[model samples]
Target chain A: MDEFELIKKITPSSLSHREVEIGIGDDAAVYESKAGYEEIVCVDTMVDGVHFLSSHSSPGDIGYKALAVNISDIAAMGGYPKFYLVSLAIPSGWNESAIETMYEEMNKLAKLYKMDLIGGDTVSTNGPLVITVTVIGEIEKGKVCLRSHAQPGDVVFVTGELGSSSAGLALLLEKISTKDEGLAQYLIERHKRPKPQIEAGLICSHYERVALNDISDGLANELNEIAVASRVSIDIYQNMIPKHAELHKLHTEWEKFVLFGGEDFELVGTISSQDWERFAQECADHQVSVTQIGQVSQESDIKVFLLSGQNRVPLEKKGYQHFK
Target chain B: MDEFELIKKITPSSLSHREVEIGIGDDAAVYESKAGYEEIVCVDTMVDGVHFLSSHSSPGDIGYKALAVNISDIAAMGGYPKFYLVSLAIPSGWNESAIETMYEEMNKLAKLYKMDLIGGDTVSTNGPLVITVTVIGEIEKGKVCLRSHAQPGDVVFVTGELGSSSAGLALLLEKISTKDEGLAQYLIERHKRPKPQIEAGLICSHYERVALNDISDGLANELNEIAVASRVSIDIYQNMIPKHAELHKLHTEWEKFVLFGGEDFELVGTISSQDWERFAQECADHQVSVTQIGQVSQESDIKVFLLSGQNRVPLEKKGYQHFK
Candidate 1:
């Protein structure tokens, strides 16, 4: 089928929100801006063989993860995702049925967030498939959680456990083997479908002077970003890092995965100690476990350190680096 | 260099607009919405081999065209271009200096329209280079010109000439030869840099009940879209269609280029006869030549026809279609 025909087949007939003035068929999509709210815009691209392997990931998983990563950026800004535009560069070998299933999977996640698929472009590529998603979100004025807002004496907290995604990726790649079939399946699912911590981000927005960053580039790299942006040093207790019980039981070197591996769509941020108590309590009510693993320091070196027992060492910002 | 360092090198340190609260360094960019205006969003992707040849086009031309096409979409909707996010999947062979030149060229066009460089992604790809640009624009409430607004007795209009870009591409690709060196250079420049008719679109926004579409696909394809969307018939005099003076002198299949060739980036739409006089005058004042080429009919069947001499024929919707 042609690009127009494919678009017609996948375009949603009705939008869930009344704010959308124009949808897929127009030259551009129009949406009404809410009063007292600012818009957050982010665009992310995932390439086959770079972000995902066609042999390893199902079309659904590829589509789902592509949108999920973009949504996580919105979540990190403590915004409500309202609309998204997806541009796909499909390879010649991809079938119409596979493309339809990809859009179907993406739409399932969009429904959960009440996001309308507004506009995009679909072009044929001579190389690998590329998917680019641009999400438009909204947040109350002055409620945005910026990474540069962290202050000394603030407690750094992370939502959910780290290293699970990386471990799952390793399992998928067969870099490590586990006899526990259930554990392997669970980790694989985690790698394929990561949950963005939007609720936790909303909680951070409620509190004052909180700095937030999403953990897409491992705990060390994310914390280093927060430190550099906020111009403050951070010290984290190595023993306090959270890990899944099944992951902890593995004999593998899980510390490297937790500290240096990437693609864990969890929120890592800092709030004042006083605010952390209430923030942690609020997150608990949502069935999300918030763990305090570090504290911001008055040092101006913009460094992150691991407090392991009686010694402190620099935490290297090591993770996935494209074009390195 | 890694992704973060590359971003730091290219990210504009100062944004031109005060509305941009967060710029390139954040997980997502935040901008305040203007009161009494709605948001218009559009995205377009261009692949290396499919959209433009790497050997034939410079890095600057590729970047500038990628952004210009997306801005044209905003112009078609009668919106003021504001911010744009660019996501580039760079091939491994591309050097850092080439990438920097690309951004520099894109920024030059962004400055012309007062658009801010917002958030985006840059990653290494094992495939061909891909560039996806999402532009966010704004229009006064209720001023959006949709393709469905055409009515009977309306006059169809187009800004600038058609087919120049396609002719230019032909010259660049050596598919056609011309004796006029100056004409060849002009066509080549036109192909590399097609201007978006934002001023003409703004003029259309001031009038009531106008239907607008950009001529990215050939004039025939674009007018067909308007007719299909508005459920009306459009009849145009073949002699009234505009063409560049140099292109008119070509002995090749220039008629086919004007009717079915793509990538003109001109604005085509319909305005009420009463509104046309004032709209044309205002566009003339802005140094834009607006030509009335056709008239909308009351026919219930959606179709487009060309009036050539004494005979009339259906205008076939033939233009660029991926995966054809």
Candidate 2:
């Protein structure tokens, strides 16, 4: 495919200079940096095989998910996603329509986030398709929550149940059949259009929440992240963990699916003991799912205890790695 | 061949940030978007054949250029680049050291710009190597110059001479022997390490320039851009066009090189006829190479005249196109 033409299609249509000083078609674009506000930035990449399969979703879903995952990174930092720049590398000989359809979906979703497509690049690759997005956000001064602030007694909470994306992957991989039409749709949507907890992040930005992260690497892998970053220990109770009942009933390897499979763009954050009630009230007001699954302690090792058994289990890094 | 290891090797050492709400390893990276400033954002990509020679340049040069080119775009808009995010696609068989070398160069330059390495993604590609960088900058209010403001009776000016980069590329490709050391080095530097005209842009931003664009696509192409954007006609006096005497002595096709062969990252701008003296003064103060080449008229066609033995010949598009 011709690279620039591919770009002209996927380019965000909002080229107005209202807030922008300079639009595209230049060496660089210019924007007014409001003097008093903080600037937030994040980036993400999606490979054809590692991040998605051609059989799993539509071009629109791929575009939306690429933008969403980048936004989720910003959300995890307690920021509102503002602007985005996308870069794509697709193999040559692909029909031009594939690139155009991807852009149509991406631009539509970009408008939904109220983020401008300021600038990016495009090129032809001989390998599988690769899409990368760098998203910039804005947050107030002293309001951004980081991943190293968790104290010894903070409670770990997660929004939404896990295993839906994993189930969706199984549907794509094994061609698993779902008896319920709605269940099949839910699994697919969960897998394809995993929403970033942007609003929750905005709310948590003000509170001195314990260590924070997004559930991109599954619960166990991400929990190990907080434990390492905060230099503290985590103890996740197996019974307290929230799993989709439908997923558990439909899948034989329920625990493995729930614990290790990734692509769940949920906000897994920690809050101080004093702010637990506030967090609860806020989640209730917003009608968001916030499940208390664990707590931070002074211990050196991260442990996961099963309610059905009397033993504790050490956490593992089952999160996805590019070469592994 | 392992993507993560390649990334780690290329990744620059990060700084301690109390302001980074969430650093890398999340769905998105959140930054402190300071208030009272409007944010500036831009992105650019470099494909192997279109932008560079894989055999001539190292991975480090590729990564550095990925960032530097985007920064140049922002500088052309009179903004201060502060953060950079890059996306790369490489063949799976590429060694990890190549990736590390690229990141090391990018990280070195990022520190030079005082810009943060916020976040980005990597993926395997079967096609040519590709690097895309998204850069964010800040501009104070009332300072951004745009390409749509030129009007009739505006004086057109360009920074530096034309055909340096063209000659440089020719020297590399045609394997020519040059007698002038400085000229040859100048051409090569123009090709390999283009210096963005940030100082000139800054000076012009405070003036009443009608329109401005960088000359990455040659003078005629840029003038055509001004003519189209401002809906005004431009007529460049053939004698006013700047050329290096060494180019004429060395090559028989000097006119073609000067006219259409691009890759000159100079600044082309328009000013009110009355401001010509002031423009010259600014150039002198900054020790910037600028020449008055043309003027805008009430009509909209762009014309180029030849000064050969009193014969006048209009020039054509001597610039690059997507397909070519």
User: Of the candidates shown, which would achieve the greatest DockQ relative to the real structure?
Assistant: 1
Query: Using TM-score as the measure, which candidate wins?
Result: 1
> What is model 2's DockQ versus the real complex?
0.49
Worst 10 residues of 1 chain B by lDDT: B315-324
* Candidate 2 C-alpha error for residue A60, in Å: 1.2
Local distance difference test, each candidate? 0.89, 0.72
- Candidate 2 local lDDT, B1-324, one digit each (tens): 654465455444665444555444544555554444445677766777767877776787778767777777766666667677777777665687888788888877777667777667776655567677777766666667677778788888888888777788777665565878888877877777677677777777777654787776677777776666666677677677787768786687776667776767777888888888887897898898888887776755555343455665665545654224
Q: For candidate 2, what is the DockQ-based docking class?
A: acceptable
Question: Lowest-lDDT window of 10 residues in candidate 2 chain A?
Answer: A300-309
Worst 10 residues of 1 chain A by lDDT: A315-324
